[model samples]
Target: MTNLSGLQASRPPEAVYIHIPFCTNKCFYCDFNSYVLKDQPVMDYLRALEQEMELTVRDNPPGVIRSIFVGGGTPTVLKPEEMEYFLKTVRTYFPNWAEDIEFSMEANPGTTDPDKLAVMKAGGVNRVSFGVQAFQNELLSGIGRIHNTDDVYRSLDNARAAGLTNLSIDLMFGLPNQTVDMLGESIKRALALGLPHYSIYSLKVEENTLFHTLFNKNQLPLPTEEDELAMYLLLMSSMEEAGYGQYEISNFAKPGMESRHNITYWRNQDYYGLGAGAHGYARRMRHINVKGVSPYIEATKNGLPRLNAYPVTQEEAMEDFMMVGLRMREGVTGEAFRKQFGRQLEDVFGRPLQKMLSAGLLEHEGGNYRLSRQGILFGNDVFGEFVGVLTEI
Candidate 1:
């Protein structure tokens, strides 16, 4: 495989990230490049996505894909027939899938119907992640979610009836007007579902979103830092008590139910990023697609719909390797760093590594460096220590 710059790839990307940037309505907290799916050019966008896939594989042919993650505004928003066509395009271009390939799709609870779930299952989507932000209906409405608690249960029921057992749900903390007890209740209900996987995150107020506007006006009643920390701690303990492993910072799973596609990102491996506002990395190069829907469609017809493309310098790649790899429980290995950069990890990052080790923020054992139990709470700081250190080396 080769990059767009005509350089041979060290290894072909085995993971894929396809974005579908249409939703029923924009969540107040979301800043992702997505539009409300009201009278949009749905079919035309699907064609453009297919074209991107065709052009992408032609330029940099993929190896046997082990994971394909379709994320979105909401991939499940598509009608049943539309979904059939979209999945068909995927099979046509990237057909060499591993027998145990993890084909996952992100869905909103209200968007999934039995017919749509059937089409998704037939299309090879074995894993489905629903955004179930909270169990309380008032909390869900305050966050601008279209679905209520009933939709969450109904969607899971439909997915199960369709014989899709590899299911996951997402939850959020630090929300507006949320209490510690509220979060504890949400976690309790979530555990009761007995799903294989859960992804819980804190709300971050980013620009260009309604939440940001409310925050700037001091109208958003977010939890205090102390409360937020308590919420996080509670979740970790609750998931552990329920026999779910906290595999990543914000993710938990039963054995073997962890998200492999996300591991690709945590390990800083290459993957094909298709559709509007997508980002792809391959052969030390990174590319970001145009964010707007119409602009992406127009650009893909003529050529690749890239907004920006750049090469990653060795220094930056090494920094990225440490930053992303350490997010995993297994952490980064000296062998992987040496293999990729042809230099000892200790030599390149000794200063930062020693500092973190001294501070009890990192633990090194058997040639692997992982965050200490204390460091997991302050992960951002631990990861920040590695940034720009490679450039000095």
Candidate 2:
């Protein structure tokens, strides 16, 4: 295998991610680049998005798109007509989609209606992930989620009715004032839904969020570290017993229902990111677009709307390959590392490998390195061992 170049890729990107930054309201825990949809320039932003897409494909033409994930504050907030135009714009540029393309959109529970879903299905969207964070109404309200449990049922029903049955929902644990029993109840209800995919994430009180403010004031009521660990263990066992495989750290899915777009990311492949505050990686270069909606719109009028763009260093790419690849239950492989960098995995990360393997945190079988049962609980620690370990390629 030849050494990979920062300016070249084995193939063009086959995955796409488009952001929609408007939401009905901001959640207390969300720090993503999003805004409340009040009087914002909706149509103008869509046009700007279209312009960005046009410029993006011109620079790095896509091959056959296998997956398209539309994420955001709430992508389903768009009116039916707006959604039609947005999806049409997407098809206009990268029209060569795989026959089995996984087109997914993120929707808030109450925001998706039958008409909007019909538009989505007609426009080639086959998957919908709803943000049903919790089943308890009080827990939902405390987390600043406007939708209730009833809304979750109705939203799933609507999606199924619209022929978009490949549905997924998100649930959260380690939330403020939440208990083990509460999380268990939520999981029970979620499993009852019989959805093919579920993403259960722990709360990480990130900076600039309301949770962070409360944490600083010592007013936030969060579960203890022990309880959080317990919650994780419980969910893992629960999902496994219910027939969902833990494909990734935070995601579980039935056979063949894993998120292909997300796997494109976890496997450290390239993808196109469009819309305000989007991030893209292609040909070993990474770029982040302007965060503000108005600024992104104006920036797109001129060019690709990037706030910053730079080639990823060879050493950095190797580090990323280890860090992200280890996040999956499948772990990293020596063959993949060699194919990407033309170097054996041990030659690049020998020290970290010996350390983690000695510590019984990583298990090696054949050519692959995966997290052991114990390593699964301390994944971040194992991943940290790979960063900054390479000083030269």
Candidate 3:
């Protein structure tokens, strides 16, 4: 453990994200930094994680961590004792958490147990986000998910019984053979649980995934672009009618129940990412840990884990700020931009901003710039302009 107080006295992060890269099976459309394991060195991974945290805090001890998110290869897959050890390591390094720190962990439907949930809560985890991709059993199997619909309900019940009040469910749309009615039913079933937050992501066929191979071969039956767009609109309208606010492009939440940790990412705030394939940004530097468990564990013995690190340039940071901040419904604040870059937002990317405004993709209101409903639908076009500006400069 390092003297974190002195290290972070000048600059403290508002959030922290830990990645767990081990999962029982990988999903069809998934391309995250995770691995399927037959014989995993779980203990070695935990020790490497501890060493990484020590070195991370020494370099950048985050101040009053407002949110901490443990995501990935099903964080709940760890046995109860291993989970405790992991959580204990977290507390050991960054001891100064915010009074209202939103500690969240991503759990799969069937992996959660009453005892494990209890341990997580006891270890200061207040929120649990279940990766219940869909409510239909057939869809779950098609996506390579081991959990069924019954598992989702039982997991929620167990979480509630464990005294974890804040709950969220992840839902996916535009699946193989999925209808609008089926998507609606999934949302309906999720709402019935009264979860505070819901993450609805459209399926994308990424490289090296089963879905990608099937898609390339024309074997995967996917919805058309129009159908996918319709699904997005339906989800937006339904969530709005159900009293959930579209805080981010893929995230909806009841008032004040947004995933604080995720907000850190969308806001372009600095956080420590500690785990295999995890990414971190702090002191204007971005780093990604090695993706393989064995490699990361072996590298940690040298005190600093094997990581690919780089310093973010001023221009790149501003571009990232716009790219990520615009994802939020509130958009990017002019004041924040100026504060981070010491220049007016207009002066920085004046031409591109004007073009977006002229095209009705962006609107200026309340000293912030946000996307119009049209822009949200065609957000890629709006974001492309910024990317173009970055490339030119």
Residue-level lDDT for 371 in candidate 1: 89
Candidate 1, position 328, lDDT: 84
Residues 1-393 of candidate 1: C-alpha lDDT, one tens digit per residue: 222222234678999999999999999999998899999899999999999999999998988999999998999999999999999999999999999999999999989999999999999999999999999999999999989989999999999999999999999999999999999999999899999999999999999999999999999999999999999999999999999999888999999999999999998888999999999999888999998989999999899999999988778888898999988878899998877777799988999999999999999999999988888899999999988775554
Maximum-TM-score candidate = 2
Once superposed on the true structure, which residue ranges of model 2 sit more than 4 Å away at CA?
A: 1-3, 6-10
Better of 1 and 3 by TM-score: 1
Best by lDDT: 2
Instruction: Report lDDT per candidate.
Output: 0.92, 0.93, 0.87
| Clash count for each candidate, listed in order shown | 0, 0, 1
Provide the TM-score for each candidate, comma-separated.
0.97, 0.98, 0.96
lDDT of 2 by residue, 1-393 (tens): 123574347589999999999999989999999999999999999999999999988988889999999999899999999999999999999899999999999999999999999999999999999999999999999988999999999999999998899999999999999999999999999999999999999999999999899999999999999999999999999999999999999999999999999999998999999999999998888999999999999999899999999888878888999999998999999998988888889988988999999999999999999999899999999999988887633
Give the least accurate 10-residue stretch of model 3, judged by summed lDDT.
1-10
Clashes of 2: 0
Candidate 3 residue 171 Cα shift, in angstroms, is 0.6
Candidate 3 residue runs with Cα over 4 Å from true position:
1-10, 388-393
Ranking by TM-score: 2, 1, 3
